[model samples]
Target: MSEHRPVETWLTDMDGVLVHEEQAIPGAADFVQALQASGKRFLVLTNNSIFTPRDLRARLLASGIDVPEDALWTSALATAQFLADQRGGGSAYVVGEAGLLTAMHDIGFVMTERDPDYVVLGETRTYSFESITRAIRLIEKGARFIATNPDPSGPSPFGTLPATGSVAALISTATGRQPYYVGKPNPLMMRSALNRLDAHSETTIMVGDRMDTDIISGLEAGLRTVLVLTGSTRREQVETFPYRPSRIVDSVADLIRFVDHGKPATH
Candidate 1:
């Protein structure tokens, strides 16, 4: 593809772009393997902040995808880093899981159920009104709101699940303070990912499924955006969206080949 144009690096989403639910998408692992082999670098940049990089790595390996723990960039990690830098270590009320807690703990952020200075939210397998209500009450008082990511929901093998956005909305309603999202589509998340690459923004590409967040983030960060239909995005939806992706394709496998070897399904 034009003498393997010197792409500085690649930033990609995890769930819809690489795998769906707990299952790996067709050739998704292969695509990662190919890019690594071609001397091209890729970081699994994802909005899913429910898991720590270690947990994410283990899950991927269990599912036959071998990714190093440090290769992933998660919303949870970014949030922790952001809050820690903001002197939020005093207290944090989180409505999430091990991933979210692990990240905060690593960054020295304190987690408490009551009287926290920050209220953090993420995807929960068990979201309850009682728990949400408690968080809301605290937020109404004075807690700052932080959303790991603002995904409305995600497709899983079992079924659809409530995304962290719902919790963010709940907190917003209670405190009248909108949450600061630290995940994808946010320039902050993209900025963190770019820091790892240490590359100029002009030569980087952000690939993902969702348009509002992923593609929009690339636009906001001034990076080339590639949209893959294998995730949450469908071709028809792209036609109606006002923002445009620099390139569109069927899946990550095709995208990997096109970027590295100049080959696609040719359909």
Candidate 2:
């Protein structure tokens, strides 16, 4: 490896980079442990807005990865922060789970369906037609639309399930109002996460398995990105995209040494 900048802060995707379907990927635990031991500022970023940081921390612990609650960043949090920054103490008509609701409440947002400032869409296992219908009606009445992520589907124990983007699309088709997605693939999410960590883009590295979301957002946010081939994206699939990652590794395990040594990995 040639001379390169050392990574002072790390941002990593949850599902594919560290774990897959509730199981920790090889070296994931070690990588996180190294980050903690080295006192590097890092956060686990997830597009899933279904679980709060506390809930996610427990889930990760069960899978042999011990991450602090504060070190986990989600689309739900980013959406809430964005809303608060845009218009402090605003209201929204929410269609999601505890995570989304809690984030909004933490930011002093009132959850309502009548004349809301925004119609918020997030990931949920059981997306009710009634709630979605209400959201559509609110949007028809001139409520702005905001969604957590643009992912159409998410993996589950059963199979692929409809996510926020899928529901947002239906609402958009019915109300002719497109949602402002606040999650991955949107650079705002990365900037929000960086702000949360008080970290600079130049000294940060983003690690994830997906090319479209993780790599692009990080690149646009001025952070070096790494694509790990252990989840949704494959090695061959990477070539299909015009953009490329700074480094390609088999898994998070492959980057453990680099992270521990505070050196950027070579392509």
Candidate 3:
């Protein structure tokens, strides 16, 4: 591979790269601190739309990862931004938590079950059957369907639980209308993050644990991608994918020196 420009900005996945199950991964805090000390333009990305950035910040802080509230990018924010840009200040029937609701409200979207313009779906632990039925009925009556991400399941101590994608599937089956996803693996989210940072893709690096979502999204967005083994994808699974990340490392700790010196980390 040819040499590229020195990375001036950074984008990283939140769950596997920084923390797992509410615990900070090893060297994750130092990695974030390095980015802050270097004044690098950075954003922590997550497909989970269950909580607002402020809410996530508090969670991360409790886990010993001190990330700024504004620096955290979530699918909920992306969905709201997309809606705001597409049709400003529209009403919607949202099936999500505070993160999605707050984002929609901030953009001046009126949440109502009466002839809404869109039916927005996002991550939530509690998915009421009555609300879903209303969303299905509303979509059948001419409302657009929008989902945060395409993740079918989410992790829990008990086991895997149905996520937004699974719920979206049910809605699709009922209404026969597919939703436009606004999160990872859909380059729209990456493009929106770049726009938010005023950063160009060529000078930015996307660090993520999952190849299917993070790597593909970054590649499609024209940014360098690094896959770390600390998350979902193991080292052996890389070859199965038709595409490849620019670099692969064991964990975020390996990239700390690279962040400080502008040199690539040892593979």
Candidate 4:
């Protein structure tokens, strides 16, 4: 018998939910420590595919989050695992950086010569005409195309930059074929996460700062969702949206408080 009740596992977001640009959010570490004290499990989830688990773990450690790679899951890793499970050890034409390549390679996929089995795109600081053109050509040749994420833009200290959706649009224009998105707002990453963590959807709470991608994704996956308005999502913008989160907080700093006020459950 299974209890369709909430448990102590917290599948949290990284970039926006826990940190602001580079610094840790106020009381975020304390909250995590509190959760740890309760013998709960937590996994940091991020849509940004530019950093590997090791890379993000180190960065978070420097910022005082003290996370391990086993506790982290990125869109890049999920994208790789999704393909490897679906297509096995097929060669792929990559248009991302070292992190994206490394994740796929670690997951049993090989980057091969042009006209490879798939076209995998991710975040690259140096996305140029040549890079886009190469991806476009591969997609045109009937390569199975995929994007690590479909975010319209990237978050920066100042504002937005070219994200996966921007690059995907360029390829879509050229090839008339849509790249499969493996990040939030899609089931690919969430389903993969459930398998990797061996977590039941009923007890999982997808926590993030964005509503469209993170919240909707959790809802779509039949999991609970908590929205922290410490980043991209604003209160005013949320009222206009049709779907509302299960719970909302000012930041991860108040997650424990939110949990305290939550409806009781059994597991």
Candidate 5:
């Protein structure tokens, strides 16, 4: 791998990169604190649109991480921002939870089912057949389709549960209209995050566990990327991808030294 420029900003994935199964990965807290102490602009990203930032921050705090609400970003927020930019103050027929709804509401979007301008889908533990049916009907009636992310399943103690992507596939099959996914692997989400931080791609580093989502999205958005083995993607799985991250490490624990020294170690 080629040497990367000095990283002036950081973007990291939440689930696998920082925490897993509701537990904070080792060194995750120190990494965050290092960023804070260095005064580097950073944001924690998540494809899950299930919780608002405040909710997520509280959850992180419980696990021994102290990320502020403002430092956390969700696909729900990106989806809401996309809608607000596309067509300000539009109405949507939403199928999701408080996080998605709150994001939409924060952006001044009206939630409705009667002739809405869009049929928005998000992650939810309990997916109502009635609500999905309504979304399909709305899409069939020419409402634009939007989804928060394209994750097929999410982890839980019970088992892997179907997520936004699975449901979006169902809706697509019914309406023959694919939703515009507004989360990871979509460069739009990364750009939106960078915009929020007022950071430039050249000086930013995206740390993530998944090659398909985090690394690819960062690469497409012109940011250097790091693949951490602490999350969803493993070391062996990374070589199977067409491209490579700028660096790969055992975990976030391995990167603290680089952060402290002021530049990633040359590969």
Candidate 6:
């Protein structure tokens, strides 16, 4: 028997739950609209740090999902929030795209290569060897290491490509320093989202596709978790994990009724 309170807020992963390969998954648009109509505080989250919320909004709009800009959260935004709270106005040597760069800039972080307070890593389609060498040297010079997310690889039309985690590993091998990741699988990300929404964990639900990152993080943060099959994890793979989600549904479509009723689904 579950002891959770009625859900008043929602935190859902963007890629697997709402979209797959830039296309809106079945019932994703309707799910977003339902949440909006219910007047519930919700956020669509992503671990991808390559694009800002505005950019992501445009992408989702093209796919027919209507999510407001402020309702969208990214690893880059979480990373910026983490940095701002930890050390205000700190400078960093960054290796990422506009999303990450803009977040740091918004927080008044000075971008530099010399004597930086941190070496910040994020996702980018074109990772330059030149920038990587600089990052390695900066870490060796005692700059703290930070990465937006620990995802080892990202999806590309051609195939899987190395992402922030893989690069962070390389930098660690070179400098003997591991980076502090500020995205999913880290309960700090969940706590940060909760703080952003002013939502309590007991009254909030986390909807995601991956068991390792999404389910685990939500469970650790004291939020009930739902695993949807519309993204990464296959149904048969659920039991392999040491921990389990509170519910396993086919997709966001199945969650619409619960949005209004706030009742636990029959498992």
lDDT of each residue in 1-267, candidate 1, tens digit only: 233345767888887888777689887888788767877666898777777888899888877777777779988888888888788556898888888888888888777877899888887788889879988888888888889988888766688888898778766876788998998778888888888767667767788888998999988998778888987789889888888888787888777666564333332
The regions of model 2 sitting more than 4 angstroms off are 1-4
lDDT of 6 by residue, 40-76 (tens): 9999989999999999999999999999999998999
**Per-candidate local distance difference test:** 0.80, 0.92, 0.94, 0.80, 0.92, 0.93
Better model by TM-score, 3 or 5? 3
Angstrom error at residue 162, model 2 = 0.5
Residue-wise C-alpha lDDT for candidate 2, range 151-253, written one tens digit per residue: 9998888898988888888989998889999999999999999999999998899998999999999999999899998988999998899999988988888
Q: Candidate 4 versus the native: TM-score?
A: 0.92
List clashing residue pairs in candidate 2.
none
Per-residue lDDT of candidate 5, residues 201-221 (tens digit): 998999999999999999999
lDDT of 3 by residue, 60-108 (tens): 9999999999999999999999999999989999999999999999999
Model 4 spans > 4 angstroms off: 1-4, 257-267
Clashes of 5: 0
Give every collision pair in model 1. none
How many backbone overlaps does candidate 2 show?
0
Off by over 4 Å in 1: 1-5, 258-267
lDDT of 1 at 266: 37
Candidate 3: regions farther than 4 A off: none
Looking at model 6, report the run of 10 residues with the lowest lDDT sum.
258-267
Per-candidate Cα RMSD to the true structure, in Å, reads: 2.7, 1.2, 1.0, 3.2, 1.3, 0.9
Clashes of each: 0, 0, 0, 0, 0, 0
**How does model 5 score by TM-score?**
0.97
Instruction: Name the better of 1 and 4 by TM-score.
Output: 4
4 versus 6: better TM-score goes to: 6
What TM-score does each of the candidates earn? 0.89, 0.97, 0.98, 0.92, 0.97, 0.98
Residue 2 in model 1: lDDT: 38
